[model samples]
Target: MNPTIRSLVVPVTDLAATKAVYSALFGEPHTDESYYVGYNVNGFEIGLNPAGNGGGPVAYADVDDLDAARDALLAAGATERDAPNKVAPGVRVCVLADADGNPIGLRGK
Candidate 1:
């Protein structure tokens, strides 16, 4: 499977406040905002996960075979927060944390 880091989720308390700061820094408004506000910085997406329980920044990586990757992580001592499932058309993912509790989002690309 070809895996590449895609979007990174940055946990924040206030979306409005963070958005303003990011906008000024990047010199561009967010490209879209829904469940999460997303900004396209160059080719990478920097997102604000306001309601995330992860408590830190998360790296969402693009994977060709999410199930395979999930299995590999599990075998290598990672715990599943959610099983791989389709979240949208042509898109699916799951959250996994290594032994140290850092989040890595395996995504459909």
Candidate 2:
């Protein structure tokens, strides 16, 4: 898959404050909870997470096959930051770190 950034999960210390800020910009969140707050702007998904990458926002690229995409990145020098985990019924996600330690998020099956 192309390096198409479909969504972003921002790491925040305070969910309530961050949610309020994003809510003002993006309006009501489609999914809101203590763990996550999600918004859909157009076809792009934006999320807020308190326990995230521990740095900046992570960009998740939507793919058809999560395993293939993740393996490709790992073979190309990326290291696994987080193993594939199911976030939703059909959606699995993972985070990998590039050579320079930039987080790469994959969202798909």
Candidate 3:
């Protein structure tokens, strides 16, 4: 696996307000995908996903092999949810629940 984060998606209650805050903090928007707004900081990508649909603040860990990453995290005390499945057509993810029930996601290209 590459073991590098491709992007981090943050679920916000107020889309416009959050976008404005991130825009100010990052200086400008790199890309906006309607469902998502991306900002580049150095080389890392941050995405803002609108609230609803069981969405929440998501922490992403990018991996060359999403399945492998999911397996490893599962071995290390993280509970897998929905296995490594596609969130969108090309974007794949493994949903995990931490010891405290906090959500963490491993993403793959």
Sequence-dependent TM-score of model 1: 0.83
Using TM-score as the measure, the top candidate is 2
Instruction: Specify the poorest-scoring 10-residue window by lDDT in model 1.
Output: 26-35
lDDT of 1 by residue, 1-109 (tens): 6688978877788878887887777766465464577778888888876766655887888988888888888899999875676756988878898998877789983
lDDT of 3 at 62: 76
**Which candidate model has the greater lDDT, 2 or 3?**
2
Candidate 3, residue 53: the lDDT equals 34
TM-scores for the candidates = 0.83, 0.93, 0.74
lDDT of candidate model 1 versus the reference: 0.79
Better lDDT candidate (1, 2): 2
Instruction: Write down the lDDT of every candidate, Cα atoms only.
Output: 0.79, 0.92, 0.76
Range of the 10 consecutive residues with the lowest summed lDDT in candidate 2: 1-10
Q: Cα lDDT of model 3 overall?
A: 0.76
In candidate 1, stretches whose alpha carbon ends up further than 4 angstroms from where it belongs are 82-87
- Candidate 3 global TM-score: 0.74
lDDT score of residue 102 within candidate 1:
74
lDDT of 3 by residue, 12-63 (tens): 7777898999998897787776677888888888888774234466778877
